[model samples]
Target chain A: MGVRGIEIKKKTTMENQLHIPTVAELMAKGESPEILFWVGCAGSFDERAQRITRDICKILAHVGLRYAILGTEENCTGDPAKRAGNEFLFQMQAMMNIEILNGYEIKKIVTACPHCFNTLKNEYPSLGGNYEVIHHTQLIQSLIDEGKLRPDDGHIFKGKKITYHDPCYLGRANDVYDAPREILESLDVQLTELKRCRSNGLCCGAGGAQMFKEPEKGNKDVNIERIEDVIESNAEIVAAACPFCMTMLRDGVKVKEKEQEIQVLDIAEITARANGL
Target chain B: MVSQFIFLGILTIALVLFGRNAKKIYNNIKLGKPTNRTDRKSERLKQMLLVAFGQKKMFKRPFPAILHALVYVGFCIINIEMLEIVIDGLFGTHRAFAFLGSFYSFLIYSFEWLALGVLLSCAVFLIRRNLGHIYRFQGRELTKWPKTDANLILIAEILLMSAFLTMNAADYKLQQIGAEHYIQAGAFPVSQYLTALLTDTQASLIFVERFCWWFHIIGVLAFLNYLPLSKHLHIMLAFPNTYFSNLEPKGKFKNIDSVTAEVKAMLDPSLPPPSGEVARFGVKDVQDLTWKNLLDAYTCTECGRCTAACPANITGKLLSPRKIMMDTRDRLEEVGNNRDKAGNIQDDGKSLIDNYITREEIWACTSCNACVEQCPVNIDPLQIIMGLRQYAVMEESQAPASINAMFSNMENNGAPWKYAQADRANWANPE
Candidate 1:
């Protein structure tokens, strides 16, 4: 029985059994988490953003903080609709999700996509559903600052040259530049800067709902412009906080056929790895 | 007395042509849908002053900006000379503002310098368009009518400025000779050199001066009428267009009012559900766009700055923001022409989409806002692209397969993925 128990313990992978508790499950048990993890459309589905979402979850769990995801209850924040000019469709989606959140009495919301973050933090108030919205990078920065989440020896990213690519919505629209930079600094990696960083950051050709369709005809690709900026920075890893920027920059890397040399990782993914998650 | 009548005759014809063309443009702009740009009054005024008057956005590309400012400021201030021209044309007076004395001399000197500036700038622009063959001006869109329109305007300005200078030069010689009816009025420092060329007899010199004077004044009148048909319409429309520019945050797309109302009612819980079906989804014709959008079409300088900045255009995509604006103006002009002939626009069996602007062009747009940012006149090409895209996706269900997949995913899974809602949390629990 002792040998069997040892084998069972070894098979219990933390990655497979993240031990995620749904908001409903917690509520049924008469316990409420402090913050609701609004895993956005990309974070919930896209393979790349999903990794970032998991890293966020791992960090939250490791910090021993009480947090819960909406599970099946969360919906897309209707960013693409508003951008694609489908205001009707956007409202329909926003209303359904807002109704669910208001019903749950959820207040503080944290999301990974700037698209979702912008819509929730800036757009949701006008629709009469208000919540204290925080981006994942902002949350990560605060956790690091408060000594709640400490970085390890930075085995993977230590001394690695990393540069950040700002998402148009986040950097230009919301002005949340420092939080991502601060979060990246925690990994003890050498941080590089793109010439057109911060307010002047180029779009990854993914904002304004462009991610759903192919890029328009033009002399140069916008993602190529952004990736060129990253390449010029001479950073080994491209640090992206927004999933849309990750998608665009990753595609741009493949276009340049430099995927073997340069890696694109989200801030959360790098931070989570550095913390030995 | 007969000379005054001739001047009045030319003025009457010019003003009539100008008035008729202006009325037609006003009516065509009225054909577009209404949009409220009345908010933020102070900001609107500031935009006008900075963008239209200050030429703030033009300086992004310094060389062209300086040349453009020269021609622009020259054209405007030189028109002050027109006040004198009008008084002279009416009352048979020479240098009517000559009573202002040194100020008049100062003004004419300034006018002569500006004429030289306008002359030099127009020549360079013409060479750039024709011989130098600038890349932005060499696209397929500039092959015929647009190319000619650009060249014609430049050439016209060159001729007009030349006529003004020749007339001033001849008058200067006539003044030096003290010829009959040749008063010692207005200064002409630059044209003074040309007085040396006037070695012909005083009678012939007077005839040369009179001929140039007729050509210059008549040419100005013709240019006024020509403006309604040319991209030069921007001279008049840029001010109003910039004044009513969209003042919202650049990234924010306006919400559809009907949808907003419906959503508001749904969220209220106490309100009843919507009664009627949505009338339409998005723009399908020129009439659907705001009057400001139509105004934008009329005001486009055809400079291709937006297309040059467009990523889609850079990557060899069919989406050109300049082309979009041109197509809008072309279609608007077509409608206006039809109305002028038939008293109302008939169903012409054509629409802005597919006929003029293609689905490929509209769909190709990345919505990057680069085009909007680059427009010197504050024309938002992205708005038209989005409006057409809205029609494609919502009304016609003709979006690309990738986009259709996304729409379906959003409809069914509440996300832009094919995964079921129950499995949305699987990313966290990776098993």
Candidate 2:
């Protein structure tokens, strides 16, 4: 394994003691975790996706579920490459990550980004990598259903005008529509619905590797159109499941000068806050 | 006999012209890179039947859908009559199918009704395009040649159908007067009504019938060849284009082969280091695209439904899915012309990116698949946009600054940020 060799170079920098253990660290102690938290590129680095990663981690921790992160060994699942039409770069990224993943004998994976969730669950199987991949919302929803975690009534989110924006990958691409909505329902918020929600949900303009590029010159920005749908719903808080949607919708809110009026938050962030984390 | 010989001469010229144009189009489409769309034969057949033959997607909008279906069915059924005219023109037989008697009358009656339907449908379509002020038609894409092309086809159809009715009406009048050589054959239920307006000179009626007959036939031949240049090519190519459409889950993207090989090598230490210069990823030029993409370009009806459905377009982004397909077709045509003259594609010092479709238009695509979903003929403009963006980012390194930051972050930190890999666990620890 390239683990020990690569670990030595960055080992000294791990001075801050975090509760999360790397997969290599766990396996070194001969412990096999039940699930691997596949914190995607966005979750690992993006400030917003990081918040989602932490909230999801808190939810798992609150339920006392066994999970570990790959840390240095993990890499992007190449969802961007496939979307950008650079299959070569995507394959290079996917094959290396798949090798590392399969080496650890990983079985179940949970991710925050719908892009990663889509790629890891659907696209990776054909390349000889397979795992039971679940989005964080689905995992958390199931946990709540199993009575592993409970939401208290009269919480901060109770009776709030919250509308959920479905991420394209999670909704249209994978048909995981109900899980996020079900999770939001637990918070006691008036679950308002956008006219274009669920299967007809409009994209937040971050899909198809569009997050990485300036939107093509067009009559209007897609995020603005998506945000307009949210505005029409007249919900005070715009709830989202995917980190990319969070970024795009947040930007759209700012563009419409509604950042103060409408709050953009991920399901995990809102859930973690609701649970008094 | 002399007239029959003259008809044969004219027919031969028309066939040669049509054949030459068809061959050029076939060659142009062949210039694209090959893709294997033959994997799912049954699915492709099913798709062709539903989308192309059944017009299932078109029915989403009731009014235009019905009119389009009428014109489509009329175009197909009217061609059956064209076959008869060809046989009669060749053998100099008057009403060559008259031998079928009542069955022939039924066919003629149906053709008359269809002819009327076709005429009315074409007129309505023309009105919708030129007068309706529909947003899809207002875009820059509909200007000049595209606009003229659509109107010209409708006008041509209207003229052709009118001539068919006039020829039949005059022939019916001539037959009623018991004129020389006016065969007492064929039903004229629709055109018989027109005979009420005819002047009683038998010679003038013969001239009108002959002129209308010649005009309709010549017009049909001219329209046949014009299809390769016009968006009306959808009339013929829709079947094969729909048949070859990508049947995979709409969001799935194909893995690049060389990238796969290189990655496989990286994973297996026993495999020797990969050799040979790697090919550029994604599409930048006409030849880089799959042939099915070229077929899509040629098959586009420019109906602009895709543009109308596009979120980016609706929000006032420069991206129009219809424009993407049109630009691809236009660039393909330019490439075809270049290839024809140069014997092979050489750098014309231009490509689809800057020379035809702009980088702004390519980048504007949100990849929402709304355009793909809205396409009546199953043309996936998002695929072309993705291909171009791939070329822009990987090959040219022309990705916007923000994307560059994301890419760099991923390359250095195993994620799309400047944070160190070890700090990833810090999200768990919090501040």
Candidate 3:
């Protein structure tokens, strides 16, 4: 049988379907989840990003890992406020979130957004909210390492050309460069790296709360400049880990009229599609 | 005896001037707010050694790194020769360390090679700055004074190295003819070749030898005093700046403690009220910054690597990280000078934010940490930009319209968008 057929046969043996449970719903049943999924504001509200969010949920369910989303209870992590220099607003949001997280006695958290991941992991501690935080890509890499999720079983992306755009917050800010690349590497795709990758990765122009505002007067939008790197990579599929990058890259591709030629997919979505979930 | 007195007098004047400049810089840095960079003793030391001493980060650009390493090593090794010159100048002796015999000769031989390296590297640097089309050196902020300042330092180094080599060559010629007090003490490798350029006559060689010797020493002293006023201060500040660099993750900006305290009080009414006088929200002037930020300004060599890597600046935005550091240093110097002249800091109807760094430049930053990552000495120009932004947002409430809308949405809707909190999890079951 083909790899896809074999994967389907193996999947049929497992009875658990893709069901996303809220932290509140799980708590009502007196059942605590193994992990709390922090769907950031972008992943929660952004249309393109919500697909990636659902894919992440699908992956968690496929792996049979008990993970619950904060759902309506989760608030913005105040990354934009902090970056925009609204320290008062940032601290207020941080205190509220810290209270909620500590009240739940939460120990582990995972998020798909680099901004949220960076803030929760790095900025939350000083405000008395400390959790064992991991990015969704990091979680995926670990799942692959544990042999729970097998990318080799899915041959959909066996030889497709893909490029991974390292989000500034994930790569340079937190030094989490390897996990996403490793997950991509496992997919058997022709991974082309941009000239600026890893610590030298260029920004998509949506960081520092710039996503919420129009860019200052410049010759070209920062996303368009970043798109030049994507075009130079000559990859058909551009893999992104951050929702902010997904939006910016999507816009850039559309502006360049290459949306028909290039596809911007988050790493979670790619992994879930590869698994035929 | 007359020459010795002149030498002593010049040395005393240079030392006194340099000491005063150092004190002024110290007090200016002290004008900044206090910060705790003293933690992580061993890590800081290691960082200083790796970055400043080893020039580790400079290797990111290999060609410039090589040239800079030559100049850096030459600058440091040549300073050892300065010790011998200082002793000879003070004691009216020739090659005072010549007592070490062959070891002194070995040191002089090494210094000659380094001097040659420095001379050539500086010449290349001058060409690269003025002639070569290096984008980093051609920023809008580098016009006029900044440009002249860089070229001037390079020319000075070239002149200083030439004077050193010519002194060695003339001394070699003097020793060959057995001129008085021109005792044969050290070996000359690079300078020995230059002996052909000197006149063979004894009196002329002596004149050339003495003239070059005096010029080299005076030039060295002048360079020492010039450091405080020039970007060359990086030579000294890079060490301490790297030592006191932010050790946390680049994404982890410092939380405003005053804001944190106020927020904590608001969240819990049972908690005691926040004490002390009301503090300003963000940096409006030099004094609002941390001592480390001030040190970063002084430590900046204006290489523009930060600007070159900046996505905003790369895409033609006004936000150049190098300019931020330059403006900070410039504004700090203005404040320091004002205090020096007026007996205390008198407001000159100017602040660092509006007077120097523009709101346009501050808002253009993407906060990507590329500048922070690209900085060789770990200067966090982003911190300064963020501080200025804080002042604009909280103190003045003059954020751009779009950003103001974002703030209101974040405050009211619990998100940057206008979506309701109730629908936040709608993505979980998105069709």
Q: Report per-candidate DockQ.
A: 0.40, 0.37, 0.80
- As a whole number from 0 to 100, the lDDT of residue B396 in candidate 1 is 86
Residue ranges of candidate 3 with Cα displaced over 4 Å: A1-17
Model 2 earns a TM-score of 0.84
Q: Residue B245 error for model 2, in Å?
A: 1.3
lDDT of 2 by residue, B1-431 (tens): 98789889988987898788778878878877778999989999999999999998898678999999889899999898899888988898777888888888888888888999999999988888889988888887887899899899999999999999999999889988898877777788799888878778998999999898889988998888788778999998999999999887666666666666777777688998779987767788988888888889999999998998777777787778999999999988888888889998778888888888887787677677778877889998988888888888778888777777767666676665577877765565544
Question: Best-fitting candidate, measured by TM-score?
Answer: 3
The digit string of per-residue lDDT tens for model 3 on B270-389 reads: 989899899899999999999999999999999999999999998898989999999999999999999999999899999999899999999999999999999999999999999999
* Candidate 1: tens digits of C-alpha lDDT, residues A1-277: 3322432343345566577788999999999879988889888888878767877888889888889999888998888877765676688888888888898888898888888888888777777679999898899899999998777763567888999988777775677889999888777789999977775466788876678876654667779988988889999899998888898899999999998778898888777777767
Task: Give the Cα error of residue B399 in candidate 3, in Å.
Answer: 1.0
TM-score of chain B, per candidate? 0.95, 0.95, 0.98
lDDT of 3 at B11: 96
lDDT of model 1, residue B182? 78
Which candidate ranks first by lDDT, i.e. highest?
3
Docking class of 3: high
* lDDT of model 2 at position A183: 88
On residues A14-52, what C-alpha lDDT tens digit does candidate 3 reach at each position? 324556898788889999889999999988998878778
DockQ of 3: 0.80
Residue B89, candidate 3: C-alpha displacement in angstroms: 1.0
lDDT (10s digit) by residue, model 1, range B1-431 = 99999899989999998999999999999998888999999999999999999999899879999999999999999899887888898999887888888898899899999999999999999988788856588666776888889999999999988888989999888888888877888899899988877766988898888898888888899999999989989999999999999886566666677767777786687987777876576778888788999999999989988887676776678888999999999998887888789987888988898989998888777676777877889999888888898887778878778777777778788887678888887776654
The per-residue C-alpha lDDT of model 2 at residue A130 equals 94
